[model samples]
Target chain A: MTSSWLNGRPCDGLPVHDRGLAYGDGLFETIRVAGGQARLLDRHLQRLSNGCRRLAIPMDTDDLRNELTRFFQVLGQGVAKLIITRGTGQRGYALPEPCQPQRLLLGSPLPAYPPQNALSGIRLFPCETRLAEQPRLAGIKHLNRLEQVLARAEWRDPVYAEGLMRDMSGRVVEGVFSNLFMVVDGELRTASLVRCGVAGVMRGEIMVRASQHGLAVVEGDISYVELLQADEVFLCNSLYGIWPVTGLAERVWPVGPLTRKLQAVVADLLSDS
Target chain B: MTSSWLNGRPCDGLPVHDRGLAYGDGLFETIRVAGGQARLLDRHLQRLSNGCRRLAIPMDTDDLRNELTRFFQVLGQGVAKLIITRGTGQRGYALPEPCQPQRLLLGSPLPAYPPQNALSGIRLFPCETRLAEQPRLAGIKHLNRLEQVLARAEWRDPVYAEGLMRDMSGRVVEGVFSNLFMVVDGELRTASLVRCGVAGVMRGEIMVRASQHGLAVVEGDISYVELLQADEVFLCNSLYGIWPVTGLAERVWPVGPLTRKLQAVVADLLSDS
Candidate 1:
């Protein structure tokens, strides 16, 4: 990381006793910064606040916004990762009295991906690792991400850029670090995140955009067979706006018209932010 | 917290990039150190090794044993916590190439609980938070423990000593930080950790001692109804040894003979260790 900050001060380390390091009791947001501004930061903060509410972690939105502004102002163009954890505590499962949340901000140069990934598309590895269903933790981008770490380790080949993960009941969930959407039977469909999956801000953007474009957006279960039958498949995240899935398993998909249009719209929206 | 060490060095902080703080991609063990010896240290190490194998994190058992011995030798009486993270990384879910696991050891004064907890018994609050079933993540004490934190946060009343957590399927699994056991039909039974629950070291010790005593130990599904019907209910952890459950919801259970006997055996085994 090029630049980092803990709380409001510049630092490269965190207290080992932070609950985030101890029990993954935390939430993180990876934002794309351009021209010294974190793109779609409000959306990210909205999601973060929702997570804090769901997890019962007290958050001061104004203070967080001020810190984010300060952290992003010094960066020209890069990815800014923000982490908020229930602060230091003595050993025990119970929450410590007078808990104070700790925030860590990091800045890193934009990762280099092949040009073809955006123009042509990327391939997917059908990961054997499945996401567990926990409704309480389903839609929030909290720090309990061992499943994603395990899924990302399933393949080392450069041919596959991302891995597709499914829930235990054989329902396609999402990508390792992105949301999955498919154009099936001329309808835009994505798996619901109510059971198990991080509800990405980019996903919310796409659903809204699809609705504006007069496309039927279905947030429900999409079986592996159903996903296979889709005319187009795509993965999306805040950093990587969208990548059409050119290949998955034995099947292949083309960069369909809807995907191309959605990509263009998302790029425009991100640039504006 | 009295003292701390990171990678055998006296330190109170970990790098912000540590995977343990980021994704909770690690395992942890809290051992009770008494009289300059960590009680049930071998059992703790065995469970930690099992966690390492399950999570695919490389561990050198001999080196870890030596480190633990050195760490405990200087401490007379306290709770020692050991955390092994997948170590530092750049940015992404994929494991860093040639990953070196990070070890953090911390010592804290043993918590002071009321004497009545052990002599009379403790009360339980039926937690609203439910544990998700992921066999791959189950039975091992990994760092992804937000579920326990959430369950423990359900009530602020000091009346309930420990909250009882049930699985997503409504099976009485265990407590927030300990294992649960019940005596039914003159048989020693406990919820199976096969689906979702930490296979605690103390729980293992109790199981072995019960079997040696010629008791029928049943590890199977335990519904709420079954839990209520149990002649006796008790909770056990390495630190406190055992605490019989005098009340759960509206039901009450007596401090039965089996609970007393198992507690005595566990205490003896721990003392010997």
Candidate 2:
């Protein structure tokens, strides 16, 4: 419940009429914390900045960073939340003119991800809910997340960790809360979010790691056939790090080497935060 | 900017950390106000209650009525907004067990519609953005409204009142801010929002008016072809009353009798408040 502000004052809450609450018209990020610091805070900032550009929301990175720094500096550990919303608007759907953006940085105790989760991985069910194809909104962490919310609610058992979502075209998109990656023919590959999937920060990190390891990375319309035949599959996010996909519906795969190697770096990145 | 509360302690502001902002997971109703009373207050309350039932959010009708009465008492004339959110959850998508819903009511100045809008009508553009089909979420106004936000941002012109939106299946749904209807065979009809679009309060009133006049009222999939051939077209919401849609792309329609007659009754209802 702790907060830091961008207006250089002790701000505790969002304005009552914030459009974020009114319309889910905002974007956000969840960064992992380690050693009292958010890992790759700059990269996360870059994504947030990119998101603002896409949504035409004004960006003040310095103000954001300072507020975020203060928030984390107080908590010293866990997850750092960065939320930017088009402050408030009237009842109409029209975007309010001269809108003041609401900036919020909340620090929370991180959910403990099992050490084995990163290395051993988890099971996933293909959700009935489909992520609508909106190339413009694709890859950005916008607040219009009812699709994800509905998909996540499909399961109640603690046994299943996450659910995989499909695009309107019935193409396997990404996990409800993480990015999807698979090793195909010894090459590291991820689903193309050009149609609809979040361009996650951890997904970016793993891509970088793939390049650094001399593995050619590719993104495109990856079908279920392409997925099931893969050497290995994994899911990732900034908070959960990287997790090998041990089973998906009827197919199961062993935790592979590439997933482990990439996850090792993600672990170090989070642990060093 | 003015507000009222049920208990009458003091209505200064709402907590910043309300779940409404945190998740964009709330429902709201914007009601018309005039001469110190709310218009269609019962219908608005019904919509809110129906929305709460669908989302599993708790509803206390008596307390809500007291709050609404107190809210209108503070505002001599304006709009009343009632927002109810499934209270705050942790930093995740999972809904909390035994959640308490937060209620926020705010009264503010309503936008005065251009008188010429009733006479000259408006220009409309078909947006590229399409609403996804979610029967459970459709009809009711909910906080997960990024689709509407993006659709609204597609155009920015004072001359044109609003833009038209379609569902994924090429079926014309509704305008970004209001429910849409047309007169065909001298019968009044509107799009069925069972899969998308909101079932507006004014839409129901218009339907009842048509029924009282023994005019056929159709509610089903409305495609562009059927809409283009319609005798007249218009849009309506509780706040704006009725606005004749003068032109759609190249097609033109003068304000028709049915549209005008219904608009008169609707306007009277609003002004009576």
Candidate 3:
């Protein structure tokens, strides 16, 4: 079952003139909800706030928090997807004066993935769809996700749980729906999203937790060769917790100690939520 | 008054879960409607068709044509904006099997621009926003247009009619909502859309008309310096026909013979429509 609230009203639709549909002028957050609590909400809100500020979309964070609280009470356990659009506009790219930003909240039942896959590991498909390096639009989970959609469309095999995408410069950046991390030379590293790719909230949380646990986390460019040569690799998002990537193409990776340790950390966090 | 039709039915709203709003998984076209005829419509449909093919969005061109004909009959004289999205999905980037493409057509009064814009010329705002190179998406009139939105937002001054944008590599690309052309020495030149830019339909028409009229038309890389040094420059889109660019920052150019010739050609075409 799914439920939606548009601007604090129980609604399943928005005006067709909404800029989100017209120009993808918006930011979104897919939050994990458990036991009626939104997990890592502050991080999600922080990212949304940063994106909103960059896009100059007016936001009242306090009001949003209250609305989310109310929505979660009915949501209980599921995923809460929040979309903040610049709202409806006339025919033009210019920002509408007195912009009425639209806030949409959708609650859906958590996806059912094979238990054994998460327990063992998942394979990653090498996607050909490259992420365009746009520094201004990078990092934020904006609505302009056609690249991800194309990358995700590259495969239909259920065995490949995710598709790994590289940037236009052929640097391994991230998975279609998650952030990627690899253990290289006994150091934890993830591609810097300064060029392209969405900065997942879980990825941020893991970086913080890993550093607190005494792991050196580095964020920089990671070439495909570097990723293939890494000791271990994994993918993460807010809802799925963590899934160790055991294979990409023909290259195989063992669920190394770092992957296991971080998985445990995330598992605990999700459980506590 | 604005009128809208969704999938051939009168509707003002769409489901919030529609991928157009969620991920911008769609293509769009803004066509001019005059005397109950859609101007440059074949070219617009051709571009839309190409974009749909690239994005793998199923489209029935014949059906779309019939729908547009019906829409324009009621619209009479206005601007017709058409959007075709990948439709609703189940919270993932993966293409929905048996995807239902949603077609939306909106009619609105033509923008009341200062008549002097076409008669004399207009100034160009040097936008800081740079278009990111993504070959797969380059030339298509896709829904992911936040860059244009941002560029347009750079200035609210009514004096600067349009903003000129460049690629990340500092190559002059196009206007915020139009294609740009420059006359260098004796040849007509427009920035190549192969790297990053929307290939405007009116641009194609102008190129064809210029070539038929014995002018050398070239589409390739154009540096900001090259544009400023050009003998003449102009912007083109389906709606407004052509607007000769008079100035950019401190640089200025006269409305040269080639611009006037092409403008006359477009003016005739629009008038016929």
State which candidate has the highest lDDT.
3
TM-score of each: 0.97, 0.93, 0.98
| Candidate 1 deviant stretches above 4 angstroms | A269-273, B269-273
| Candidate 1 lDDT tens digits, A1-273 | 378899889996898789998899989999888878888888899999999999888999999899899888887688999999999876677888788999999899877778688778999999998898899999999999999988998999999999999998889999999999999877999999999999998999899988998899999999999999899999999887889999998998888888998998888645633
Report the C-alpha lDDT of model 3 over A38-132, residue by residue, as the tens digit: 99999999999999999999999999999999898889989999999999876799999889999999999888877765578999999999999
Worst 10-residue lDDT window for candidate 3 chain A reads A264-273
lDDT of 2: 0.80
- Candidate 3 docking quality: incorrect, acceptable, medium or high: high
TM-score, cand. 3 vs. native: 0.98
Selected candidate, larger TM-score, 1 vs 3: 3
Candidate 3 wrong stretches, greater than 4 Å: none
Q: Write the residue-wise lDDT of candidate 3 on B1-273 in tens digits.
A: 478999999996999899999999999999888888888889999999999999999999999999999999899988999999999977799999889999999999998888888889999999999999999999999999999999999999999999999999999999999999999888999999998899999999999989998899999999998998999999989888899999998998788888898888778666735
Weakest 10 consecutive residues, lDDT, candidate 3 chain B?
B264-273
TM-score-best of 2 and 3: 3
Q: What is the C-alpha RMSD of each candidate to the true structure, in Å?
A: 1.6, 2.4, 1.1
